[model samples]
Target: MLKIKHFFLVIFVLIFINCSKDEPVDSQETKPLVSAIDIGNSELPYIKIKTISSVLNEPKIAGEMEIYINQKRVLNSTIGIEYRGSTSYRISDKKSFGIETRDASGKGKDVSILGFPAEEDWILTGDVFQAPNTIFDRTLMYHYLGYELFRNMGNYSSRSKFVEVELNGVYIGIYVLMEKLKRGPDRINIESLIAADTDAAKITGGYILKIDKTSGSDVLGTHPLSYYDTNWDDDCRYTEFNSFRSNYDINRNRIAFPAYGAPYHSNKYLETYFVYDYPKAETINAAQKAYIKNYVNDFETALLTDNFSTNTRTYTNYIDRKSFIDFFIINELAGNIDGYRLSTYMHKARGGKLKMGPIWDLNIGYGTGGRVPVNDWIINYNNYVTNDAWMVPFWWKRLMEDPQFRSELKSRWTELRTNTLSTPKVLELTTNTSNYLTNNNAIIRNYTKWTGINYNYNNSVTELKTYLTNRLAWMDSKIASF
Candidate 1:
């Protein structure tokens, strides 16, 4: 009886073990299969990614990801990616990401996935906030054209290419595979500044500054006073560039790199606008902070002086004038509400003048911001919306007040319009980009997912053409007089 009972127990254990063998294995450990696709002669490159994270967190986090270009495997590596943008990030499904390419260990990188001028970091922009892009602004060609105008005009602008990105096997819409603004061999092209060398000589040479949303960690400066400040200049009231605000206490221009906070001082507000970004907060020392602070103080001092334009020591001494003029044309033509405000970047090279561009974000520009049209002039914001959260630099407005600056601006504008920004060229860019997007099956999928069937593609393109035509003409007429 004991032998029989032992035999039954052994059989029961064998049965249990056999049952567990058929269970599905963990998906993470295994390589994922991508759906094979063959679309001949595509407009933009088709990109697909498979992320290892089953749990995708908010404000996207990095995971092991694979990249497929036109169904051919290109890269399999670890990367850091996060949903990026201000209002655009709110989209639940159609989200954009900031991609950081790295080696398998997530340190050190080897990038250049899509021949887009070879940069490690790229942006997968969904561009979905202005859903269905009414009046040509939503198709995203407007923003593309704006950047290309800047680049094609011989100024440094981020090179962008359109891509249909598939994330985790799901088709996300058209994304612009764009270079992230960083100090690099091909980008910004500034001398490398290091934290180990705390000497002011090395530290003051290269720094990137931005004027944007105030962060507690940011280096900031207070506005001198609003246009409506007590000593108001009702008629010739344009003299002040930096001012203290009434409704919002501060208009912050932050130090984006070598991101260190200022030391506590009696008048700390005097030097909060230049936050450290590159060496980062952890590595930066006190001497580096003081060096940047004094450098900025000198620049601001020159800006605020009575003879900013004509003084023997002038504003031109502090900046690269061409960069400023080029940047102004892009913003003014596009009517960027966020111009000189958010995502705006400036860098000072080791012993180099403070430079204006390599123009950044313009998704809401080209009359897309909804606050103003592409035809609207931003040099003076309709003389009504002066209290905007982000105001144009007094430097740009003040420089316009100078005859020399105005002449330079008009000359530059003419040169751009005649070449890259000409009506015909602008139309061609929009049409080509639009055609490429329309040719992709993902275009329909993206729009259906984001805006449904009623969305009008033709009308949007037509509206864009109209905006560009009107914008070019208006700017030409006005700029010539300047």
Candidate 2:
């Protein structure tokens, strides 16, 4: 009986020992370098994000993320991340992302990143990725350069910085950590308009609108409009829910698109729609919506009727012409094919004239598009791509017709060319950025992961410099005539 009792005790001890053993560890934290590039010695700030969920598929899923800068943990909070961009997302394996920082309770938490102002919204723009042979902005500086140029021109463009990123445990590549365009004191710096502010002065101003496809991250509590939606129609196609179609066509004529809507129609360029961004589709009240819509209509009417009579309200009565001039100069210099149309942002402050920008999404710029020649204004997009669904607003072309507008544009261009947008200054910015990345081994690290990127870094930089030099020369010669 004693021997049998001893055997039972031995069995119990063995069972306890087996059960207590740590479950076979599957965490890859120790050896997470999936790419050949060794990021241990990188000079750029290292951002490591470990998500609680194994995957980030869409904007709605809030994954718990622990953020570390240079291996020191700074934020351990919930983050909603998803692939951003329409063409970039579909074509590239290395995808950019839209991020929203949230707290433990799932509300937006303001956190300052890379010394920028505390904001819940941020973006991680991936290095350019393309198919075998295509016109890719390989320098990866188009966005940074464009934003810097705009900011230097005395505007509040999105502030961005280069940083190395690690997802889960794998080093992805170098990404541009940028502030998302939102209304804040440090950002757009516009007055807030809520549903309750339906009074005359409060409702007349403080609105952000986008002339973009309804495809990216949707306004909160609203369904995203598919790119396939019929964007242009006789009824103007814009519903009161999210956006409003322009009362005038691209030619300053009455609203009309004979080919009507998307699916590649020839006359789709005739229409334009302004998507409400600030108060958003879910929050903006009817009075606020009506006021903005009417305001835009009034601007268009005033602009279209300028040449009709001296008594007609001038276009200057509706807009800040300086903002327009600066906006035009930056877009023209960057050779931004999508300028004035897609990704364009315009806002109005309380009792202030409508203004253009805090420019956003400039990745596809710097002579990438073959649709228009390098010498022409991008606002002439309609004249080039006759069938594009999104067209430049009649505002730009109409504004250019004004002698004062042309004189101001010419003066601004000449002034900026001598300093801010000068060929040497622009090239210096490009070269310095290039040298910094290469000297710090970031270019090698990024190119190693994103093999689709232009691996010949020097050639890409030379190409960018050449493009800018030629573009600046052309603008200098052409703007002199104005």
Candidate 3:
């Protein structure tokens, strides 16, 4: 009986030993592992926050980190095993992040410092406000207002899109973007009006601009129309108008015109052109004289024979006579105030015909700048002499000196002024626009400041009204002459 009891005790002891071996050791009182670090904070306008992680170099017994923003749980990740040393996370926000982390394991481990995500380092102060009224008035009048007038005047301008939105809880308006324009390689043709003067050698490359639909960025490039000074000498004027009849060649890269007019403004003005392979010097040379006559003739022949409808029609002989008559009338009405420089004329390459382009920049008319007024018939008498000197080529000057040009001008002026001179209608439009400005003062002010205009509502309105009336009158006179 004693032996049997001893055996049973031995068996029990062995079982106990096996059980003890199977159990895991205390792992040296291991600290909890930290896998990731998270950061949470207040939401920002135009910004988004994503994820955060850590980088670990030295081996740790145990690690754990808890991230929070405004006391909110951002992330809880294993520290020691998952990420041995350090890691990074991406954040999406207009502003930088403010985060805090806690070491829960308490294993005497040094906590890693958190860094902001790339491209989100700045903190928005939320202090930006709308610009003043004066600034907006100027910007609206010069850019937006002028654009509207141009459209009304039958000009080909980029379509505009305007909108208002809230940024950071602040209402902002007058945001604009335009459509992209595809510019082809520049080529010399009678159809092009803008860069016709550029030499074929200089017209080398082309570009496709993803233009902003609302802002008219494509039409103005970097410089706004307001950048031009009111003074003729200080203003950058388009001198090619007198010489190039066409503004742009939709199909090819080229600009062409008929004659060179007087230098009314600075030559360093903005002129639209297609991408072309040519040197700037050569282009300028082509613009100054009849250097591309043969090219023009060839372009005209192509236009006349081409299947394109606009080009075919413009190149016809009848259109040429009509264009000549139109030009003569506009010249006489404005006292020959550089019509060729202000407007564009387009011609088709195949038929060598002509058509009227958009009318631009007539704010200084009616002798406003100590020049001759529009109604002064006395200015009409000099039409023949001016035409002979400017419009007619040196050889054709004496031979084409006909009095019929003057008569045509006078007759057109009478018809246009009588039909279009509706000052009250224009004022009504201005009043409605002014109301819109009032409602969206914040956006208007912001844009005004961006354009560098002083904030003064009344003054801006008065100035705009005056300019509008003057410009409208000028347009009426031109149309009548047509």
Candidate 4:
């Protein structure tokens, strides 16, 4: 009887020990233990993951990560979880894993895949814009948003991606890996083809020749004129020939046209491209001058013919008219400032064919800063008072000196303001954009902290009205002089 009882006790003790060994260890030990066990296993790579989700309790295990090993799904075993906020799993016998995080609402976030030798999967090339001596990870968020905005606007910009991994148990925003583009030929060079005059044949031949020369080549073409060329005005001449000649120096190329918030004159870099290879020989004689005058007239006429509907003809000449009208409509509908200057370069480049392009550099417009406080004020001052306004009266007085042009301009402005104010699509897109109230609040908070202005709606309206009225009065006097 004593021997049977001892045998039963020993069997019970062995079973209890086996059960304890099979049970999962505490959460704290799971991470290190799994990591240690998986080390040099040479079978499957272990992955440490931190997930952000709208649902799911802290340290919860994801039922099925739906992992793929080298694009093949891992079907046999379950993944383990650790830490309240992050999870870790030993993915033994797998080359890659595709991870998808799904919320309680049944929406699946995009799947991210990881494999052995992670760095081999991601590659970056070119002259990445980086601040020296700083880790690329430190400024990822800002650079990402900045580059994204610039690219979305259709400007020549760069590309970026992110890379990160964990060591122990900490979260980090890692390096922003970037690939650089070799500089391409300037758009100005292409524009020169328009002057060659042999209809489709000459134009096609010019482009084909250029492509052949540049095929598989990294070098930029030489400009037609040097900086010291006699055709340039004293203020416009490039003092340093070598520095000003390069296509990569945007300041020297200044291809960016005049837009709201930017200075009125052509950028210095742009001036080089504009003046280089300009047909100074053709313009030196009276016949050439006459030809240029005719060319300018034809350019203006073409713009009017192409862009203006029969009803919109009167306002066609002023480059920013549509942009200004759009701005006023948006501001009135949203009760906030979000409009900015549509660039003058669009009209200048297309000979008035195209109307608008992507809005750039909105840091200031919409009751933001500068001496002007309102859209109406900008229109009134630019139309009437400024020496360099694009409106008819300003252009007529300075360049055209024709009374008919001024009258036509006034008529156009009156018609446009009335039409734009009545458009519903204009009203809806402006008013329905999200976060206006929040953005306005943020703006007010920032201004109050910095400038101590009480930036309420009434105050904004009052200030805008006062500035516009004053500028209008000033414009009336200037028009009278014209």
Candidate 5:
């Protein structure tokens, strides 16, 4: 009887061990899948986009996006995503995207994402992408730095947040989710100009103009505007319905293009065109167009013909001097290679002076060379790169020539260096941003998936800090002379 009981106890132990084999063990280590190595969960916000047709090649593609922050679902919304940027699009496999959040009926829906004010249009700008442009912003902090500095100066720069992105279940890498520059109460904060506002009081005021290459609608080939008056002004690339040319050359002389049309002559760099940005090329009416064109023309005329012999300056009547001063300081601070030429924006408000602000596109900035002296003013770009397609406008160069303007600029620069833009402060911002990315393992994950660029994340951050240090010092010495 004792032998039979012992045998039964052994059989019961065997049955218990067999049952435990099929159940999960809390102590056992589980290896992650192969894809999880590159695209695993992390501390940064994760934006996953699933397209309806699994394609995002065109300018606009229907999709649904879900954002997760620390593994918790924050937003799920329908969206229209599109490849954005002209040069950035052509240069990288990981393209920037313009996202418009939508409702079920496919109309733009306003919803707050990442705690920013509710707005439909947003942009996801990636860092360097897969381009071999080694000098490009691999540090991924230039845009944020430039915009933040401008905002600190009491200007309205685009608000941005860093986030990781995945499209169609494939991790694309880190992107700066930013607000698009547009006319809104929370954005540029300018009065709107619609098609019917053709009267004297309504038409005399608001307009947003940019000096940029013909893109977006030009690439889409859908602008309803007519060709510019080519009979007199032979720059046929411009259309009377959309743009107007500067009355003076870069040297502040009468306007004259050496040759006309697209693929313009080398001398075309001397000429500038103000493209209609707000009302758009298609919707801006004849009366409204004439009003803004004349206003800008008047401002230029007063600036160019000014004697500067007295305090009663006529140009001051047209422009807000403080805005121009701040804009100049911000661009000079960043060493923006494209500062006054490409991606430049100027706007006017109802019954207000023409203002230069809401600075855009600082990707290729922060000590990037543009054939100019490292310590020189970016507005003097033409003094170096003589034959570039886009040249710095005469506005800044002329403004610097004015004693009052120089005094104002010097005062502003001095105030900024004391606190907001001091070397230690700027370095702190850069270091903090880098630490956030590093602590979350985002830099490693981003570079792992978007390889071949050979980006040195740590070194890039170090170099950025060094550049800012030197740049701020140089600017300090130069602005002192002003």
Candidate 6:
């Protein structure tokens, strides 16, 4: 009887020990990156990004991060992240981020996060409310409007989706989650111009360039041909490069592509203004540079010829006329003072003509800026500046010289005014966007997180609506006279 009792006791003890054993795998696997929350469709989707303290302190450095969306774990990877923007970078406590999807080991998986287009790189743009020396464009819709008009113009433009981001368990404000421009199946859609594509025909197209503010980190390269001042009738101001100390003023535009080397440092003399944007300045070979340079020179030669309109040598031969017209209309319609001069982009396909734009960076368009009178034409660059460092290229003045260009532009404007650019359509977009943000509690949440920040949706919408109504009427009158 004693032995049997002892045996039962031993069996019970063994069972208890087995049950008490900890299952690390189960606990780790079941633990979520964040606690779940119910969200409505009207609200912008919420995202939680987990980060280590090391990364937050140095936002410039890339680190491993985990992402959760609307209560579901989505991505786990190491990413290269950096603070984005120039003026906005200096002003805002809320930081905009440029994120590279690759993990610390440089491994990445492609998946659509928060329903944005499938891309490895993404930008989380903070509202530029904190930017310095700027009249507050309270609408916060300039960028959204810029891209919308670009799309309605039937061009391939960056698709943006609104999102609320939570970093390391802290609620950050609303972000315009968007695609980072690059050569891809979807992004830039040009044939790959790898170093191996040395053939003249293979290399010509598929290049992207931009005119934007240059930073110390920019990979600069130069054309040996002297830089042109583009003063129209004034002889093209030539800057002969002697060395690094050449005090040549930076050109308004930068060379964004065909950079071959990826070196952070280079021995070559940097272009006075053009920063190599693609193919890493270290990667582009001598031949590639010559090709792009010659092509640009040839185009300019045709452009600058006094009899370009009357003669066979026309600027249309070198550019996509429709795209250029649409770009101009959007900029002019928005009254973007920075339109033609800054944040402008142009691209050349392997065999296609130079195309103007996928319009970008318009936080200060409309009546929101103090640079140029909101009601005045932005093309009148001389109205505000006496000796501007970045002058609008003579292209605008010359194009207007051609009767055909003007006719087409006027016709296009009229049609769009009835269709996509119609006032009713624009007002609807404004109303819908505002309601969506409000319904999602995004506006309230965003301003709340920023502490001391105030947002009035109705006022922003009213200003935007009023500006559009007047701008459209003014454009109709001006275009008709043009």
- Worst lDDT 10-window in candidate 5: 223-232
* Model 2, TM vs. native: 0.85
| Candidate lDDT (C-alpha), each | 0.60, 0.75, 0.31, 0.28, 0.77, 0.63
Candidate numbers sorted by lDDT from highest down: 5, 2, 6, 1, 3, 4
- Measured against the true structure, the TM-scores of the candidates, in listed sequence, are 0.75, 0.85, 0.35, 0.27, 0.86, 0.77
Q: Which residue pairs show collisions in model 2?
A: none
Q: Which stretches of candidate 6 lie over 4 Å from their true place?
A: 1-42, 53-78, 131-136, 216-272, 306-313, 451-454
Error of 4 at 238 (Å): 7.5
- Which candidate leads the pack in lDDT? 5
Q: How many steric clashes between backbone atoms does each model show?
A: 24, 0, 87, 10, 0, 18
Cα lDDT tens digits for candidate 1, 15-48: 7444322112233433333543434445456665
Local error of candidate 3 at 152, Å?
4.7
Report the C-alpha lDDT of model 6 over 20-97, residue by residue, as the tens digit: 222111324432444233344434655555543433212345454444444444455555666665545545567677
With candidate 3 superimposed using the best TM-score fit, by how many Å does residue 151's alpha carbon deviate from the native? Answer: 5.0
Report the C-alpha lDDT of model 4 over 210-241, residue by residue, as the tens digit. Answer: 10011010111122212212222322222222
Better of 2 and 5 by TM-score: 5
Better of 2 and 6 by lDDT: 2
| Best TM-score among the predictions, by candidate number | 5
Score candidate 4 by TM-score against the native: 0.27
Two-way TM-score contest, 4 vs 5, winner: 5
